[model samples]
Target: MVAPMGIRLSPLGAAVFCLLAVGVIYHLYAGVISNRYAAFRGRTSVDLRDLLAVSVEAAVLGGKEVKAVRDENHLEEKSKGKTREGASEPLTKGDLQSHVKMYNLLKSSFPGVTVNSEEHDNLEDEVTWSRQIPDDILAKVEGGKLVPANRVTVWIDPLDATQEYTENLLKYVTTMVCVAVDGKPMIGVIHQPFTGFTAWGFVGQGSNMQRRSSYSTNPPNVIVSRSHPGQVESYVRSAFGNGTTVILAGGAGYKVLSLLDMPSSTSGDMDKGDAYIHITFIKKWDICAGAALLNAIGGEMTTLRGGRIDYSASPLNTGGLVASIGVDHRALVDRLPEWDPERH
Candidate 1:
């Protein structure tokens, strides 16, 4: 003998259960199924101009984090030791905080795109961000239409010149972001937290900053890193005579800004160099944004051997970098001695 069990539900209860089931199903589709289907089919196209605008916002957000850490006097240093080339690698709380902010902003804005950041620790953070683009940034968009999300790569430097930042040289600190499409850097945004100055550029479109009116390479006022001078000074001297002015500075972003006609308040009296040269090993995150900016304003940034640096390649750039505006880049490359990994 078998006993049969029967279940009964009221109309209201039945309706409520149905509604809950519908909600669960809807969430499942929206959160998981939809995304999987999208991936299976193809990623939706993203506008480069919109991406640039978002990158600018991300950079500004990172700069705010940096400034907040410094203003709060939380400049705690976490020594990353030295690189293979013997250059000091300094990390700070500001770097981590800024990196988290920038990484979140970019990932949230475009989930499918690849984001490469300078700081790689404590990356799992949940943050909400608004998708609204600033009116000023929106107005600058022109001609850059939709492109596949997978074809883009973003490089971020949350805090450049940590050593100088630790020394309280606030003017040299910058947070930068770059958008590279199809392995080519197409957009750059650099923000100086201390000065509240931001410069953005879109290659082939235009830039908010202008070239230095006095920018020239006649005597080649070259900017070299203060932290890692290496043999760059001697190379510059050999390339453009001993009398050529060599400006020692901190931060690749600041050096690139020196090449631009920025306000004296932001640039200070550092004798804005017409060219920026670095011989030692440098990370792509350190230089990608500056390279994009230079490319936007009819400037050139390439290896000392005058070969294009592919953004999608390895993060480390062993080849020396040289950036110049309002001058013949190839001519400058020709003057510099051939880059030898073993020698200068």
Candidate 2:
């Protein structure tokens, strides 16, 4: 064994020792420090909450930017043909260029993050999972396991309700983000750019509402998509027994907000009334954010036949969906025609 040398340290030595000790301590508690920082920023996922906030701001601003430029160029009429179903606008000429540009910029920051956006379909870019589902939620999923970050996926609708937006129906347009692990949506964000209203929710952490409102009406208001208002009338009649009023609305996210009964009035005293049902066969991006909101508030959003949607399975929800704020979900689902998963 080597004998200890009794060499005394100078002042500089003590300072260096203190610095090294502090560094080690910080390193030991690095996770705690990181958690605190996440909390301070009102975030939990490695890059989710902050990414959503930034993406939303960019989308909102981009909408305005695009609209302003459209007006200046008098391209509104010229763009009409492009908005139709199964049509494409020549990107080389009159592209709504800002939408993809803003989305790509926001997405690029999170290297290797898998994303399913309305503007692009690139499955190869899906990244590994870097975050775990919260304990409370994870406990409920039978044998649910957290995989690598590369398996995680995010769905985005940078500008939902494109037709409504082009028609100048500003309230209907929204920006949406949904985070899924394996094939389940665990977090969602919905932002209405024009109103600057936002709703967000995570699996176990609950939800946040920029505007809070309650459901207090008896008859229960039902909102339907403007594009497909008549599709669910019979279902509504069957579910509510012919007394509920159907309100034609645009955008799945906006309609979900209505179901939340958030007050839209400036006075802030008006009652939004109660909402009981929203049913549609829209895309995953259209309803994923809404599902998060409904789930947080103890509401239910399931396939039209009342089946759980696996977000990772497919972007198109051919089976349709029924979401509700108040009522027995299973009972309502049972009321529909004989459930057929294959037909959805």
Candidate 3:
């Protein structure tokens, strides 16, 4: 009665206060000075930890101890459950075939798509044009760079390393889709589609990747492609500068995912930003899904030229693009046009 003038408190409120206090105290004990220092609760989520190791932690909602938690369509895994037509197709071959199928589909869907690629007539387009169009007619040279100049989806099997996708072949593949607009990639879809996983970004729209444990999975492991092509060497050199060690990963999507793997890094810790390996010699389709996924998760994807990729072009979007996690991955690409990975 004597304290009736003060705000009333309930057990819930007391519990909340206790949690807040304890968290602060623990944070202090751990020298956790910023939000980035706070530990993340899940394996795939971006959190305080800086190393995003390949992990599949338990579900967060039930606080239960399960084997793993997955967001998106982690159900369509090749090892596990759902099965669809052509499900067993290898990533490299499947993606190549899918591009043609999608290209043909797009030709009917949009009526303006041009196919490029002919290695496999399984339905995929020719190297730079659909089975419907001739290669010479679609091919063009811009500033000495071989530009297919076709506004359509282009397929790139950057690194078909088996080690990366053996465990989760459907979830991890070095495949991309480019959709150009005005001579640039407007929409790019880099999908580990078989796993129902993906990263996508568009010009002016933004970029991001999907979390298999769901986008909500905490403390995700960021992966880099084990092998980046010669075209990408210059951009990689630019992002890492003179002495940055490149961490080889499995797929292109994984390359972009590497930044979100380990948390704990932020604005002040600039090196954390620099550690990212830049994929600059990218095409529209090559980074579409990854771009969208990264953009959704506080990242970026653009041309080494520092402009947004346009998607509404013809044939396909075959320009040089770069994908950066959270830093100026292009800072290297932006300057050294003469960047030659062979020199290294």
* lDDT top scorer: 1
Local accuracy of candidate 3 as per-residue lDDT tens digits, 1-344: 57558787799999999999998898787664444443321112211010000000000101110011122213222322221211232233332333344444433333323434322345433222122321221231111222223323433232222234444443344344444323443444443333333334443433333222222112212223443433344445454344535455555554554444432231122111222333323333345545554555555666545567554433233344555554444553455364322232
lDDT of 2 by residue, 232-313 (tens): 6666666666887767667777777766656455213322323434443457877887786677667778877778988886
Poorest lDDT segment (10 consecutive residues) of candidate 3: 50-59
Q: Candidate 3 local accuracy as lDDT?
A: 0.37
* Every candidate's lDDT: 0.86, 0.59, 0.37
Query: How far off is residue 51 in model 2, in Å?
Result: 3.9
TM-score-wise, the better of 1 and 3 is: 1
Over the stretch 1-344, how does candidate 1's per-residue lDDT look in tens digits?
88887788899999999999999989877878877987854566778878887888888888998999999998788789996668778899999999998898788878888899999875766754566766766676664587788888899999999999999988889999999988899899999988888999888877888787766677888999999888888889989999899999999999999898897776666558889999888889999999999899888899889899999878988888999998888998999987674464
Model with the higher lDDT, candidate 1 or 2: 1
Tell me the TM-score of each prediction against the true structure.
Answer: 0.86, 0.65, 0.41
Candidate 1: segments with Cα more than 4 A from true spot: 1-42, 342-344
How many clashes (backbone N, Cα, C below 3 Å) per candidate? 0, 11, 97
Question: Measured by TM-score, how close is model 2 to the native structure?
Answer: 0.65
- Best candidate (score: TM-score): 1
lDDT of candidate 1 vs native?
0.86
Q: How many pairs of residues collide in model 2? A: 11
